[model samples]
Target: MYKSLILLLLNTIFINVLWSNDYILNINDDMTAIKVTICSKRPLQLTSSLDNATHYLSKTSSHVEILNGHQLRLTKPDSCHWLIIPTNTESTAMTGQLLKVPTGLLLWRNEQIENDVINVQSPKAANAKLVNHSLPLPKINHDQYKWPKEPSFMSLFAYFGDFSQKTLRISEQSGSNLSLQINWLSKTLDSQYDSLISWINQVARSFVATSVLSGEQTVQLNLFASHSSESVPFAMVYRGEGTSIDAQINPQASLSQLKTDWTLYHEFAHLALPFIDRNDAWLSEGLASYLQYPLMQKASVLDEREAIEELWHGIRRGQTNYQELSKPNLTLAQLSSNMMEFRSFKQVYWRGAIFWFQVDLKLRANGDSLVRLLNRFNRCCRDLNSIWQGESLSAVLDQQIDYPFIQQLVTQYNNSTQFPQTDRLFNSIGISIANDNQIKVLDRPKLNRFFANFKAH
Candidate 1:
């Protein structure tokens, strides 16, 4: 608790900066929370997430609370001065939970400011300042961390908005690197970043080898500090073709964690498909997760047996982390419903991967492969702006080849909690546990052929 600010309400002059907005965010000395004060000349009814359990606004009470409309109506009779403290140093990508991360970095915003209405061209804030920061975020030579480039859209999306912007600010700790930053040009790829991108290119070449997608691509790598060393706590891969393809990384992440983590390949695989809806995360995330393994095989990152092993582990992880619903059995329809109750994101990811795996196996049995189908899908809808859904995507995929694997999977898994069981698939490919508990290939002629044909050698 840094008690440096006073509760002065009389004769206060609001200092304005950046893009004409009177809002200014001052970092606390301890670097825990940011103090946001906006001196206004007129009355404004400020609205925050009052209904949310997490108020999102930590240091206030008098002017903010859930009422009839959940808006904090600020009646500025004479001089409207509002101050709110939004906690920034607590949440990080490493913990997956909002905890104190004391990186002294802030998400360039007055936490309560509405970015959607503010960042837009038509609805730009009336008096808001647009002092966006310069591009290629300057590198800070702090012993704690390093950011290779300037913050871009990803950072703005979190602090400001999703749509791309030209300028943003760090506000405090300019010379310090105590936080994570992911933007178009925020961080550069060196050891961990290089390894991840190399792996991506390897799989990408493999995908291209199958003649599915093109190889000429540009991906923006963003690195940030980590909260936990165990795994990458938070990451996101977004944007489409003609747009900057972005991937997030934790600079503090160990080489082993960075190399072994499937997040890179998983996100990288998403670039193969056109953008889909969040509700259909199963399709997008699942496809990426499943493809990562084979792509790893192409990169020599994981062998056939190791690929199967990874799939096995992913299945177990999805099963273990699956959120149980009221209906013990879930169908693809119920599972895909935007109704948050029936949705299990983990289940969707793995189960959707399993569906693809089973379909690929079945298709290969009938003299076809998943790569060919994906190639056709990519050819048909090459544009990212053209959003796709399950039905339309399935219809187009079926049109690609004689077999309709995507359609079949949707038909089978859309109604219940039937996740893919990889045991039989693995067994068919000669993957088995040896006496030492390591994965090995069984000496079966047919199985050897299955393994050989499963992935491009």
Candidate 2:
């Protein structure tokens, strides 16, 4: 009994120490500059995504030296180092000024800060907004707040400004409920607030239900309303510190139009997997493309036939892109690695969808499924901040099953210069292309059953 009690005491002490805040941020009243204080004496290096980050650093600091246009090096280690970063106020939106969490931008002895807490001291007029894996920050005092968990390297992106905020609590049947915090960065979105929130709630619930992810989760969605007439002009998901999405929406667009928009579904589907490296973007983009249609169908935004048609349309676009951009010697992996340089998005995305589609068919043949595998992955291995290489992700998934199918497919497709052959695969599932270039969904039992099972799931 004594030994157990001693062990428990030690564990409690360790937990507290591990979660202790290591950095303090003091922001000025105007939100134009931030002063950062590192709690540790360790030598620190700073890197920024900004091209002229050094120009923004306070010139009075002799200890800090410019390493490059994007990086800074501290000359000597001290008990505490004060770094000040100034913001370009004129260039940013009126809703918020982004003050990046510098603790997240640092390298301690040239390594990532894996276990540090960042505490913020800001003026009451300015609110610090950051998405992190930990529970919402609790205020120490009226002006002081600390992040409760170890900061994910990716979670360091933060913004400070006066903004409209709304929280939606979604109840889950199993595990913990999901807390979605929506930050409206623009006043223009106010008109569609009710409809927009409703659409987000529906899709978020649909995602959780379809993926079977029951963990208590928090998602921070920053909605930036644009004046453009387009609906949901663009959106991107960020992971590591926490799951957050930045979506540019048009306030003028109807809720029905928002529900049917493929961009939102695609971005939400990304939550199913860990952050994959950009070199293997084909895998990540492919998974999102493949799942988006089904997700829309499941959410009732698209019917069975409509979903299948959309899928076919995307696949055909991929095929057409590959034919036009085909390089005689370049493999899919090579093209995927330099995808941006080659503008091979359609080919990479669609080919990736094809890869997953084929894998799903194979899995279904054995009474297993991509959905089941993804559910299992979510339950066991899905870490929002964890970065995975393509083959490494495949290897991990392959370990979950009896046969090594995922890795085999990845290897074969990565090496082949040709686009994945899907004629036989589609025919086997009762989809065919007519000579008139239209896709026909055949009335075979296999195809009907596939659609039925898809909707039922």
Candidate 3:
């Protein structure tokens, strides 16, 4: 009798331990179970069968669990997804009670399941608006930020702000769009924000889809003084306040005067390109840089001389070695990896734009222009997914102009060793290359001859 009681007690303890080791993610659905193991090591590996299921892994910060046998059961509450398994875990300690807290990646699959419902707005019943405004303002003596009465397609949200003292409020309205309220503590600051909104909305009119014009789609542009990440986490950032059109008083150099100059034109230009996936990232980024100067000139926002100078600037600062650039293009993976290697190569931004500029110049010489090329891209290809890395673009050009010459131009641009001598090209454009490496337009040739009418502005 005594022996029997001890055995029963041990069994009860084992059940309790098993239940205690589980981490409940409260998932609602299940899918094909891909075997995954977690470990406290450098690399995690999953079995070959789970290769197709690796994309759904997400890491959570709520709690840590170190299982005994160094392993624990991972389950999905629902049944339509596949899970990815991590490879670095030790199989021996696969199941048990934890000894210490360790960071482990959570692996799972994408399956359709009902999400737990919760009320997001109910907590703040008294205040209808969600507002945060602890951002520091520029010392410039001006109230610059205020939204216009005219309707706009853009909306904005800011986080990590103190609402009571500072001044901005963003909240969803009953309609599809959101309400943006910017209260500059200083009136001058309000004016700055107002000017910013005016510029943004003016450019945004072309960006809104025609079908969505009446339908509600929220687009917000959040501007803040600084982010913990230093640079803007997103492409558009609130760097600083400008006291004058030319003087960008960015003390932190949040947005350098030079970058701001480019950013204003480039960010606005993105509306013209297809924004579906990474496939078109090359075209999108390249086009943004390519169009920025031309568009600015068209609007009479900058001088044609200045725009050409900027293009030349890109070429000067751009990469010269074609082999190093081509090495990354051998495979998609290498190309992606090279993007992260900022120290080694010039980004697609500079190099790609310069290449397009050369292509444009070459095309014009052959009686074809970028305008024709753009119309072709817009009509023939839907977006990047439809356009693969092949001879399709080249083939399209052949129909319009001299295909052989265009190909030779592209080859020259792609080859780092082949570059037009700066001194020669600059002089041809009526710009003199200075000994100190500054662009001096000897005569500042007529804008009509070089760029569109807007460039002469």
Candidate 4:
């Protein structure tokens, strides 16, 4: 009896001593009962809860209790979490780490817990944005773990807002090297989503030949209105033919059901852009815009005449807005230097697309075609590690298409002080730019550009 009592007393003392250490460890799964001893270096009001428990805030209390089996349990203590995640938790659900506070939270997990902080971006304390890191609270932890480094705004959107999107099985495709899945949560005319998916998959098949990525890789598609520090996360808000903003889709778009097709096609093309030096924003964006018309034609979404007509209108509209487009006088160089500017960057889509349209005309005159040129460009872009730029692209185009025409077009666009006369340019090909108040087929010499191209091919 004396020996048993002595042993029990030793165990009790060990537990108390362990609890007094600087950190408390937790590794809980779907069936776990996690316990955390909350501490705050600064006076803090902690607001937190488990999956099924009611949220509780402790402005005066010293501790909070959380039951297990919850989805996400966060402790926004006055300061960042300072506790060390014990070594045992490394192979459990808690291995993947996320500090549930602002980016300024300079804390780490495990042995890295001593003042070694991964870089992060913090929003104003007034506004609580989604934390940029992936909430890697996976139930099954692995042996080899790669903690996420600091995320860009684009990546932050991918990590946080994805949880909020409702599931819509947009489309899926697999290639030997890569796989892609597309889905949009909106419930309205899902047909637009379907069309976008079809167009993207066609581009992927033609460019990446990814029809075999059954299980190795997967990509998810989502959309949102106000994403945190993200670019291209917002859908096109079309307001008539000349206006669109990434921040808000024009409430007035769908002026006619027919116009929605090109808008969708334009956004979907962004998905296929190659991993190039972002400095080549003009090229990738311009190429994508230029390619959209042809891809739509190939997919039967647009005919030859419709494609050229669209380009003419885009150019005219951008030209009229020329004063505004150049107001900032930010060159493609400044725009590509950072993504923040890329979000607000103006007219690359419009001006660059027109440049390509002119090049297409010139190439056809020289017995070459846009379709063949794009096939070559796509091949160069497909190499994952290769970086592409205007110089490299010009070299490739020189071999397959009209290089002088491309050069002149690029120069005119890069240096243009005003928007081109889009309607007058279209007049050269026999088409008219439509007004926002009216849609009509012009009865001029627009010997259907589409039909001529199909015939020539």
Candidate 5:
């Protein structure tokens, strides 16, 4: 029932980057089976699927098959040939086999492909050709990368990396444009991914390209069909880390069919925060959820009134869910024992987002805004290599704001399952909801600069 509510939750499940493996990908005419030729380095003990790739492998033991539930262990031959089938299973915890880019387009992680060369062979294409890619060989920093204990055949697993530039779909621009990373994964110009590419570039350039948030960062997207219509379409970002993020959306679905929420913006929001443990997931997902509204408006992806109204609506959703399902007399602390074992996006995302917004609304009342506070954090720690936890982020925010706002909000509210009430805050901002699922923004003096953060454009 809550499957749809958890779409954004899966977006940031980025893991360790796959190091190195050369690949020759051949797609069949029916789109059902794929033949992947992996030329890996030296002795190999394990080739794991970060998502669910091994599930589709023919498990005859005669061929590559699922191992240890999630990993794919080769049967023989240090270098191997594996066939992949298209399947319909979806889950963040267990999905890494299939490369789900746009229809007729495939997205492979940089790690799965070989370091030096990769070849693409699709029945629908002109011919099998080497894909000229942009990822420089990762420096050989460690010597421990040897064939693990087992059938010793290889020396080293080249750090080819997952989510690589080799998959960009642009067919032309042979000269200078090959170096430019801002493009799509499809080779055809008429592809819907091409149009989506333009829209995404517009959003990044206008909203995040220059913001203190995203500076000189490159994003490689691995697309997939949305797990469900209710799931939020989200992108897992890997600006500096490997095992980069994976996002889900209906490959053939038109932009109009996208959820009313700005899915891209929401996923992009994760880039604003450092990764946190799943236990404190609210921190990362909350920042993504909260910022999506303002940034979506900044990019003109959403109207100002629409952004605020959707936020207010989300607040109600969180509050109602908590009221109905939460334990009695719970404290809103970071480690609230009442927290659900499986975790609900309603609490972790919606309520967590409201927690921060509530903190911001109050700070704004005193001539300060969360925008200024976060910008302060970005100034010193925006480097992609550094990961910041939610607890530490609150500490850093407190330092920037010169007040204990985030600290207090997180400590006070995060300890309990109780949601921070937003009725007063919503009313103060002047949003009115009429009967037939409609919303109107009222002209309130306090509402004047409430959206100043969105004016960055």
Candidate 6:
């Protein structure tokens, strides 16, 4: 009987310990306030991502105190709760009704929390818009909840108040799948909904067909109507516990205009590899620029000739920018590292693309291609959490295919002061530049066959 009693006591203690890391987040009726309950068995130290977190707090348990900027000390963690009333609920555009909850209030402990579960309770009404967050918030056991890998700042970003949601499930030829959740924050885009969805599907399909995405991935797309006149004003990809994209579109843009826009294509193309470090911005931007046209061509938004012409024009722009911005005694690596200070974006991006184009030509000459290499790399070495430097990325690619060209180019171009010469490379691939600087594709059998095979894949 004593043994049985001890066993029952131990089991109770174990359950408490396991549930201690769980959290309950109750979003108030108006969606302007959030109540956070920390289910802890003992005292804990908490950290906040937002420096002005105290300003948002309406009520807190007596045990909780602001120890410092972005730091919260919990003297008695048991049954502790805090009510946060956020005030930074401004929309990105003036005409948009979207009010984002300043829910960047990410809380963490001194010890890392694993398999953190957050139970979210929100008022359910037909007109009440569902919260759009970067992390997955699915209905689990009759409650809206999320299972985050760990508690971090990225997990805390969410927008509430006004939005329409749609989901697209895409399956590629290679069996890779993507569940894309799109949140339309701008009511002006309602008329272009179908067109926007179609365009997004096409771009996603093209990426998957090229083996840029492997396994199953979920992405959250937040669409906001921009004040700019451009078709797609801007777009950015955020990575943390998961991947999300924030895109701004013009309300007046047509479906055809949206499809032809390169902004979304370029943003999605960024998923081709692991996130490159900011210092190696050239490499990351270069891959996107180089792949954008081809991806557009593959999606039937642009034909082969148009893609080639775009590439040629882009290369010329890069070359021109390099010539104008080149500083004496400054290497490409130095320029790339300080590109923002020098305003050498075009040169950095174009030079990176030129390097890739040259590498592709060399690979094709050896009866291999960049696509094939990337397909292999995606199958083996794609890690969401990994941040790759230019040299490290090249080394990994070389390991996959036993090819030394990628690393060799990295070493050569990093120290070189001049922009990469692509005249020979283009000519070998059966491309030429006319006197007027227009791109002309010659009758090159191998090149034609390669592209034909490329399209088919």
| Predicted model with the maximum TM-score | 6
2 against 4, candidate with superior lDDT? 2
Q: Please give the lDDT score for candidate 3.
A: 0.37
Candidate 2 lDDT, tens digit per residue, 313-416? Answer: 89889988888986868888998999988888898999899999998888888888887777677677766336788888998889878877899899888887
Query: Which is better, 2 or 6, measured by TM-score?
Result: 6
TM-score of each: 0.53, 0.77, 0.44, 0.46, 0.58, 0.83
Location of the lowest summed lDDT over 10 successive residues in candidate 1? 169-178
- Find the 10 residues in a row with the least total lDDT in model 4: 136-145
Ranking by lDDT: 6, 2, 5, 1, 4, 3
Once model 6 is optimally superposed onto the true structure by TM-score, how far is the C-alpha of residue 424 displaced, in angstroms? 2.3
TM-score of 2: 0.77
Candidate 5 residue-wise lDDT, 101-161, digit = tens: 2211112322322353445554544432222222211211211111111221111111111
Candidate 1 residue runs with Cα over 4 Å from true position: 1-211, 215-217, 240-248, 254-256, 322-326, 338-343, 420-423, 432-440, 443-457
lDDT of 6 by residue, 101-148 (tens): 433453444455543566666667665544443334332332444543
Q: List runs of model 4 lying over 4 Å from the truth.
A: 1-179, 183-219, 224-233, 236-261, 271-273, 276-280, 293-307, 324-346, 384-387, 399-412, 418-428, 432-457
For residues 1-457, what per-residue lDDT tens digits would candidate 1 score against the true structure? 2333432322133333222334334434332344444444444554332223123446553543333423454454333344444545233221221122211222222334432112111113543222121112222321111221111222211222121222111111112111223232332334354555444444445444434453223333344445454455666665421223344556566555555666666765676676666666678777887887766665567766677778777877777656444345656556665446655666778888887777777878787777666755655554433567776777777877775566766766765555555667766666776545466667456544543553321
Arrange candidates by TM-score, descending.
6, 2, 5, 1, 4, 3
lDDT measured at residue 222 in model 2 versus the true structure, 0 to 100 = 80
Stretches > 4 Å off in candidate 2: 1-23, 37-83, 88-117, 124-156, 169-171, 176-178, 212-214, 428-430, 443-457
Error of 1 at 416 (Å): 2.8
| Candidate number that wins on TM-score, 1 or 5 | 5
What TM-score does candidate 6 reach? 0.83
Relative to the true structure, candidate 4 reaches a TM of 0.46
lDDT, residue 435, candidate 1: 49
